[model samples]
Target chain A: MHIAVEEEKCVGAGQCVLAAMEIFDQRDEDGVVVLLDAEPPEEQHAAARDAAAVCPAAAIAVRE
Target chain B: MSAPSRVVVVGASAAGLSVAETLRRRGFDGQVTLIGEEDHPPYDRPPLSKQILSGEWPEERVWLRDEATLAGLNLDLRLGVAALSVDPADRVVVLADGSRVTYDELVIATGVRARRLPGTDGLAGVHTLRTLSDARALRETLAAWPRLVVVGAGFLGTEAAAVARAMGAEVTLVSDLEAPLSDVLGAELGELLVRVHAEHGVKIISGVVVREVLASGGRAAGVRLADGRVVEADAVLVSIGSLPNVDWLAGSGIDTGDGVHCDEYCQAGPGVWAAGDVASWIHPAAGGRMRVEHRTNAGEQGMAVARNILSAGHPAPFAPVPYVWSDQYDRKIQIYGSPRGCDRFAVTDGSLAERRLVALYGRDDLVRATVGINMVRSVRAARALVATPTPWDSIEQGVTA
Candidate 1:
């Protein structure tokens, strides 16, 4: 599975990091989301999806 | 008891959509049905008051998931229909179109409706922001750059005022509180927000009650303040607050007090659950019954409800450090927890003079919430303090102020 993020759409809520720190991180300068892993392992798919679903801004999209 | 084979979710907004998505993701192959009152598919609402209202993003951009994506979920999608009532004992829901659907488990995610000012019904040029249609109508009206009067100092009203002012409209913000958001963020922060709006050319009038909506020729002309002064306007937005969309559950035998009253597990009754703004549940960590209207809470609570429904009789409690944010002009205000009724508030990082800081709210000698104004990283770290509610003295001791 591959995940993509839109920094311009990111609201800096830091929800992605909270849901899956291994796959997502937020920049310290501003809380815009940073995709740590565009392609995560099999076991991390669920967490990656959760991060996408919980994003209030709909900034994260996961393609499986 | 075994997991239910059929799950029906009402309300197709953020929370309801989240439940459906999570269920499918967690391998729930049960027959899932999602109902919505609006014709459009599920969409994000936070942008309604900011991006959509400002015309920065088109209407289609606010959709939570594209049609192809939502269709991939294999849901029995019902749009442009309302649930009239439910019979918990019979496990049946009656729709407005004279149809019935029986479910083994029911999730009610019907959110809140914007409260309208009395006697303002059908008045042209008067509006309320809630649904996509509402935002679209308001945006079209704002294009004319009318003299807009926003009644209410809450987040929605303030955000709309900022957007209108930025659009070159003559904007007047009227609030009952001493300052904007003072009721939730306290007077100091509220005054700061007021100053920001004032600097941006928004005429703010506070500590006043709106007596009525003034009209002429069957259209909204302005608003008459309780103090007998009238503020003329080409458009007016009544945004005092919202009421839970729980009227349909009138005789459902489930508690519909402030909202659908539920336990810490989001269960309203046997085989019944509630989420989103319409859910008033007992929060274990806060040790109280609270209803959050924030966008993030809706998705989080919906996911929790979905998992709990499939937990096989051992449903875990839904306790989250609620998060809320509002965008007004250049300000990106964020809150990690509930700051209402907090007795002690201190700025731990940055300074209010610069309008960028991380402030902490303490209640009962424990850190209850954190507020951030353009200082996102510090506020993100402060969540730990609110999650466990560290003692006030310990947090203060670490403060370099």
Candidate 2:
């Protein structure tokens, strides 16, 4: 699965980082989300999808 | 509680909706009935003071689930239906509409009511922001840039100040405490937050309490401080805090005081569970009963309660490393783990001079909580330390002041 993040939409809620740290991170300056793994393995898809779901800003986008 | 043929959830907010949705996600396809006092569907509340108040995101953007998705769940959503009480013996929920629905399982997520200052109600221009209508009404007046006096100076007060300031309105925050959030977050961080708001042009009057609302022309003209000082303002936003909405459970025999008392699994009794801002459950970390009013806690606890009910208490206790986040303008405050009972604090990154860093709080040699000021990675990493805390010296091994 592939991951996409809209940093501009991030409100720095930090739910994505907590849900899927392996694939998502946040900038220290503004707390905008940073995608660590653009293309996560199949095993990591669940966490990546969870990151998208829990994002308060709905900033993360996961595509199969 | 075992997997049942029917489950009824009251309060359609975050926790109640989470339980109902999680039940379906966990393959509980039985008849599910979700009742809500509010006519609108479930919506997110965190943005009410942030994006919604600031008018950055529209009202629909804050909706937790779309109408299509909600309909797809196929759950009996009784919107605008107020639950009068619950009968534990009969396992039935009585409604204000004079209808009773029998359930094999019940989940209470009544949530909380915003605490209003005495004598402030019935006064024009005085408001407490707890619902969408409150946010929308307050936002409507933001365009005029009226002088806004925010009482309490906690998360909601500070957030209201930021939102008002963002709209180019004059904002004054009257807080009884020396620093905002000092009661929850430590003094040092609270002071830093106070500075953050002060720097953003929010006139924070600390160590001062509002005695009464002075009125003019039958409208709130200003607030009278304890020191006989009157702070002139057109509108006053009263945001002291919130109280658990548990009055409906009165005489129901389920156990409730400040909130519905429950076990670590959020079980109040057999076939009954409670979660979110209304559940005062035993906290494994704090070693005492606590009610967390944060959105994330509501969601997590709701999921945990759903799992435990389905698993028949086989699931692990809902021992969450408490996490809460606040957004005031450009700066964001994120905290994880229980900061209570902490005595020592150390900044692991950045410094107070810059007012941007990750500070770790500890007590009895074990790290208790971490507060980050625009330091996301450090805060994220600090979650690991919550599970396995570091001693004072170990935590400070290479930390710079």
Candidate 3:
């Protein structure tokens, strides 16, 4: 699975990090999103997908 | 438990919509009906304070989903209709439009309404935000109103004040307590919020109560403070708090005090569940019951309830370390776990002088919650510890590094 994040669109609500911290991280400066892994394994797919779904800013996108 | 062949969900906000969507995602293909009083479809409420009100995001940007996508969900979408009564015994809901919808299962997600300034509701230019129209109306008036008077210093009021000041409007934030959010966040962090607002050019008035809204020519001109002082403003936003929307359930035989009381499973009655601000469930982690008004809690709890509704009685309890965040003056206050009534609180990282720190709420020398001010990564890391309730001395040892 492939995960991509639009950091510019992130408002830093931090929901993604809460849902799936393994795949997402927030900048210390402004809390913009930074993907820890562009591609995740099968075990992390549910969490990565959940992170993308709960984001209020719609910053995360996932492709399987 | 027998599988429900039909379901009726009341309230079309975040929690309600989540219940319906989660049910669909869980493969519940039975008849589903989603009812909402507002004509608009479900929209995100968090941005109403910052992005939408500050004119950074358009009104439609807050919509949860497009009409075509919502229609594709294959659920009966009832908008602009109010549910007058919920008859749990008969498994029927009476609508204001004289319609009766029977269901094998019911989910109450009718979230709270903004508590208005009692006498000021009729006054023009005075508003309380709990809906899309409220934000739209306030945003329109804020563009022209040079001075914004925000009553109450809680999250809603402070956020509104911050956004107004960002728009170059003069803002006066009035609070009855000496420090903002003191009872909830403890005095130190509350005072930090006060300093942050004051440093951002918002005039802070503490320990003063609002007596009544003063009107001029049938319009809100200003407010009359309890101490006989007047704060002039072209528009006033009252954000005292909210009351749960459970008056319709008065004779419904469901246990409700302040909010609908349910077990850890969100079960209010047989085949009936409640979620969001409207449902106060017994928290398994916290050992008490509390209703969470934040959007994240609403969404999580709503989804959990949906799964349990399909669980056929062997359901897991919805116990979580509740997390919520607030953005103001370009800084974010993020909290993990419920910190209300915590016995002890200590700073674990950074310093207050730097406008960045991580504070831990401890109970019995064990960390129960964490709050971060501009220290996102630190708080995010500490969240795992909160799930297990780490000890206080171990946290101090880690902080020494």
What DockQ, on C-alphas, does every prediction get?
0.67, 0.52, 0.54
Deviation from native of the Cα of residue B165 in model 3, angstroms: 0.7
**For model 1 chain B, where is the 10-residue window of minimal lDDT?**
B392-401
Candidate 2 clashing pairs, residues 3+ apart or interchain: none
Each candidate's fnat, in order? 0.59, 0.44, 0.38
Q: Which stretches of candidate 1 lie over 4 Å from their true place?
A: A41-43, B398-401
Interface root-mean-square deviation of model 1 in angstroms is 1.4
Two-way lDDT contest, 2 vs 3, winner? 3
lDDT tens digits, residues B297-378, model 2? 8888888888887896586678888788888777778889867668988888888888788888888888888888888777
For model 3, how does the per-residue alpha-carbon lDDT over B1-401 read when each residue is reduced to its tens digit? 79988989999988988888888877899999999999999988989998889989778878887787698789998999999998888899999999999999899999999998878867898989878789989998888857888999888999999999888889999999987788667777889889889999999999999998989999999999999999988889999999999998889898898889999999988878899989999998778887999888888888898889899878789997787889998779988886666787778788777778888887777888888999888887888878996887787764521
Candidate 2 Cα outliers beyond 4 Å, as residue runs: A1-9, A36-39, A49-53, A57-64
Docking class of 2: medium
lDDT string, candidate 3, A1-64, tens digits? 9999887567776888878878888889778998899998899988987787667666677878
Q: List the residue pairs that clash in candidate 1.
A: none
Which candidate should be chosen as best, given TM-score against the real structure? 1
